[model samples]
Target: MQQQMIDLEGPYRLLYCSSKGDKDGVIQEIEKGVSPNLADYDKRTALHLASCEGCTEVVDLLLEQGADVNSIDRWGRTPLSDARIFGHEEICKILEGRGGTDPVGLDSQSPCYEIDHTEVEMDGATLIGEGAYGEVYLVKWRGTEVAAKTIRSSIASNFRVKATFMKELALWQRLRHPNIVQFLGVLKHSERLIFLTEYLRNGSLYDILKKKGRFDPPTTVAYALDIARGMNYLHEHKPHAIIHRDLTPRNVLQDEAGHLKVTDFGLSKIAQEKGAYGYKMTGGTGSFRYMAPEVYRREAYGKSVDVFSFALIVHEMFQGGPSNKAEPPEEVADRRAYEDSRPSLSSFIYPEDFKT
Candidate 1:
């Protein structure tokens, strides 16, 4: 019986079975008292391989057998991060629902980009930006420069804050595009969680749009196309689609090369995962100014909502700062967005082809 091969062939069998998503092979191994978290040379567990290959059935089996969803491998990567980077949206939801830990690394198929916090030099660190959730700092790591997004030690202890941070980190790990910010890896500094990415010094599109006012049609279209391409990639991502519920100038970044890359997946969602069509999740997300009508109304929304928010962004690209200027005041913007009326551009000057 396969059960008799535990000592002689357990490691190879478990690794091979997990890699192949063979539920039966894994079950027999586990039934013979093999630990689900058993690792090979790299310390990668069965759950880790299942997560990376998006073996939903096998993942379910391993988890049912008490596999450690949050188990960290030798590289400090977790199964949750593995599911994320390969566009395994269903696996991501499963792992998240199972309370996966967030000690992260790049997907198994990609080159490991995780940086050791001990190797980082903090003397030259500079605070480049801040947000409600965390702050972005420029720091040196292993002789290379990187942007470290740090969560305060006090704030990191909050369960809600940690959940949100984990969600963003997971989603960000999956995205890889020239028009999307690249996620290097993550680090834990005592009580704080720090995620690192390639540092782009040009700042965000919000900064440039705020400074330069409205852009000409040609320039606006160029920026709009970059966002569109990135959004399209997310929308058509394999296994499931991703909706950037908050697609605005603020979430879009500009590199030193004058290229636009979409950032901020904190408010993003996975559409059509887990066998649910137009998957309905909690509502009332995204910025009121750029929010879709259905989203503002708390109605069941699909990926099209991103297009609605993207339209507002495209409008802002040509009309200057925000599309909400002509709407009701900030205090009543949500109500106005959902009730008073839909925002619109009275007129637009662009190429004839762009009208379509």
Candidate 2:
């Protein structure tokens, strides 16, 4: 296939190969004296295309072949900037390490720590959180505190669940954004998968809202912006966008700096044009009260569902209660959400133009 491409194209074989994610072909073409700095019609190099597609191997090959890492397309965006904006942290790291892009001012923080399981002190660990899939505990690792999620021992024998857990680990390991939880690492404790992460002493937004009532306008907007920015980064992510099919207040955690970082990827789906996964059960998935209509109806959904859920969250944040006065029956609730019914405004104090 690569040889066919190499023969089919004349001067721009390297760009074609990179665009096609043909790392070997790109290397061969470069070795054949094709300039690695060649650009396409829009002035985008193989590095730009590979970075946008999250073709890390191809990118590395290009850099090694003397490809200009700082090569910019018409938009003046660097490969490192594109990678960072699209949630490809490792790619950004590589670009930076190669002296292509400046990271001195960028918020690039990827933390990876290796510690023996025996070094983790679980004696003072306490139940911190829970979800349909697993349990979370606060434990001390290497004298620093962290949140540890334990894969249910009962499901240890479930092959599918185990596979999904490992998949989550793979995804989590690549994530490095200030608005997303930093995954420390994973450990095998008995029959459980213990996933460690940076612990936010400040609890979830759900806990704060329940205790303090409605948040002030500025505070609400601040938190909402943090979440929106995070979601935007995720949606524009390279290779595939991550749809947090479960974007509820409970999954949003606040840090000491008062910034919100999204947590949990169990129900996350890699957004694509088609073939997104969905369950066909009677009860809805991932907090129906905050679920998008498309998701509740078991229809094909993408990143927009998360935006819809965020709107619902903002509504609840203002209302200080559930979207529905009395949680409606499954059919009615589904119909209302699908029909674009807003929560009762008689009791909620919302800006008139909010729905607009």
Candidate 3:
């Protein structure tokens, strides 16, 4: 398949090979002295294709072959920019280590860029799980497992949403830690968003709790500690403090090693101050059951809101059911009153904490 692509016309072959994510073919073509910096009609080079495809091996090969990492397309986008905008953390790291280009800066010629990811072949890819957004399949890349999220066409729309999504992608690309789910890269097709990421085989904490009724104390404590550690990394990191407003069990995935990872930054925000947590009015978002009391009332809140949600998750882990189960009318009234009396940024203490 790669040879056929390489045998075709100039750089288009490289572009085609990169788009198809044929890493070996790309390396073969580059070794044959096909200019690693070759550009297509739009001035997008093979590096651009590899970066967009999250073909880290091909990208590394291209970089090693002296491909101009900073070469901007007609649209003024470099390989680094494309990798970051598509949430390809590994590719971004490679480009950053080699190119020294800024991923967050907007290209002058084109205010926006689009990724066209094809559906990777499903064979050999383990179907890990499915959700309202799409199906997540696990595949092996460079000897490591990666989660490939393929969203349907009906979910993606025009430039504005794409821009927002890319912004989030860039943010995730910059995140480097063990606890956060790593963004591998993106595969763009005419009508789909194929997001490749590090695969966590154990699935979500919610799944585990549901299937087992509840976790043993040690397991529950371990999960909570992992969650806290991840949240601390996000909230205390320099340059920008990320607030994961949605910290529900469903978003907390575990790996085979029993380590917890946080996923889905679609509702995350960057804090302006060291301890500040809330952002501008972006409307109510996140799962209702796990939402902070202040979030529901259109109030400004901060990192503590996540703490509150985390408290709720811990409560659920101990309760053996969903956190927002039916509450008596008096209890609901008391809860509402308590919420109204507290500051938006106040940390919520679980009732169980007092009982224990």
Candidate 1 TM-score versus the reference: 0.63
lDDT of 1 at 289: 72
Task: Judge candidate 2 at residue 288 and give its lDDT.
Answer: 72
Q: Which scores higher on lDDT, 1 or 3?
A: 1
The TM-scores, one per candidate, come to 0.63, 0.66, 0.58
Q: What is candidate 3's CA lDDT for residue 191?
A: 49
Q: What is the lDDT of residue 142 in candidate 3?
A: 48
Best by TM-score: 2
Model 3 over residues 165-248: C-alpha lDDT tens digits?
667766775554446776656665544676777777788988888888865555566677778867887887556778888888
- Candidate 2: clashing pairs of residues: none
Q: How displaced is residue 348 in candidate 1, in Å?
A: 5.8
lDDT of 2 at 5: 33
What is the lDDT, from 0 to 100, of the residue 153 in candidate 3?
57
User: What is the per-residue lDDT of model 1 for residues 82-176, given as tens digits with 9 covering 90 to 100?
Assistant: 78767688998999999986564334444334456787765568989984357888998666677888777765888986777676676666554
**Candidate 2 TM-score over all chains jointly:** 0.66
